[model samples]
Target: MTLAVCGAVSACADTSNTPASQRGFFGGIGAAVSGSDERRAAGLEQSATDAERKKQQLEARLGAANADAARTQVQVQAAEQRLAAVRSDLQRQKERLAALRAGSPSGSSAEEAARLQKELDALERERRAAQDASTAVTTATLRNLEERTRAIGVALDRLGAV
Candidate 1:
């Protein structure tokens, strides 16, 4: 009887140091046979979770960054178009000035010639002012777009998803 009792006790005894609660959870391994294995498993699981969460966050931020980049691109294109228009207007003014110079009356009164010359100078000055204003606006618009693009790129870098 004593031999039978000892056999049963030895058979029921737990050999490994792993805790019972950390084992047989839904009949699957929770902890591990070795303590280091348990710790490594925990670290790996945590790292995987952290990586997944970061990926989701980066995806959300990327959408916003892409939208900002698109908006900036549109602004840049519009600024370029306005600049082109201003340049075209300047070209037209040059053509008009050339035509005026070529068709001046040969023998107008001295006073009349002086008045025509003054009119031409005033028109040229006005056209130049308009051209300058357009250029300034276009430059400002392009700068704004460039700043926005830089902000988007910074965001992308910060996310580290790129």
Candidate 2:
């Protein structure tokens, strides 16, 4: 009977087996770990999303600045071309006026004097308008460049790049 009892007790002490109830605790720990890992993953994903949004906004502003620069260049070129044409026209007008003054009497007739004066005044006005246009184009370009430079500088400062 003692020998039989010893064999039965050895059989009950199986080294490779665990109770089923303790498995629940390990499962709960695994679930908690998974939940914490999911929270960390979500946080990382949100950070990446925010970074991407900022990059897109910067790109959009940069593109707008480049486009504005191109438009300003075109406008400045057009203004320059118009100024050249106006200069040529002014030269011809001056020559005509000089010829008219030369041919007229020393004490000119009232009507002749008035007509000549009117022509001169019209030419002067047109020249001034052309000059004004040229100045405006130059000023506009400079201001636009300055604004863009300042904006970029501020952005760089925010990024600690400057």
Candidate 3:
């Protein structure tokens, strides 16, 4: 009878049939064996680090783009000013040529008129050249500004997503 009772008690106490979590007092050994918590922590840490690195790279790119845009804007303004000054000078040269033509009917006056005409022609050519250069500079500045704007937008979107 005692042998039968001992066999029943041993069978009831056998923890091999139970899960590891249920076998331990606090399931500490089971957590160590799975290591899920530690892995999750490591994954989270790596994600944070990657996010920070990406943000820094974006910031640097944005700064550079902004600086480039500013410089291009300044160049465009300078080109416009130069074009305006050339146009003003051309107008003054035309008025001077007209005045010379109206002065008198003498050989010396005629020679002066011809000289003024040549100067007027040169001024017109300079004005046209300045206008063309201004147009090219403005176009380039606009293109650069648009590209930088697009890059900034993309960076902002990425930052939001992160």
Among these predictions, the greatest lDDT belongs to 3
lDDT of 2 by residue, 78-160 (tens): 77775565556545545654555555534434355455456546645655665666636565543443344344334323323
Q: How many residue pairs clash in each candidate at the backbone level? A: 0, 0, 0
lDDT tens readout by residue for model 1, 5-124: 545544444324544555454212322222444665687799999999999999999999999899778865666575555445445544544554455534443344344445445544
Q: Candidates' TM-scores? A: 0.42, 0.52, 0.53
The TM-score obtained by model 2 is 0.52
Tens-digit lDDT track of model 3 for 1-162 = 866654554444444335555655434343444454466568779999999999999999999999999988888787777566556655654664565456553565566556556655754665566567664655554344334434433433333333
TM match of model 3 to true structure? 0.53
Which portions of model 2 miss their true places by more than 4 Å?
1-34, 105-162
Candidates sorted on lDDT, descending: 3, 2, 1
Give the per-residue Cα lDDT of candidate 3 at 57: 100
Q: What's the TM for model 1? A: 0.42
Instruction: Give the winner by TM-score.
Output: 3
Off by over 4 Å in 3: 1-31, 104-135, 138-162
Worst 10 residues of 3 by lDDT: 153-162
In candidate 2 the C-alpha lDDT for residue 49 amounts to 100
Residue 114 deviation, candidate 2, in Å?
4.4
Q: Cα lDDT of all candidates, in order?
A: 0.51, 0.54, 0.58
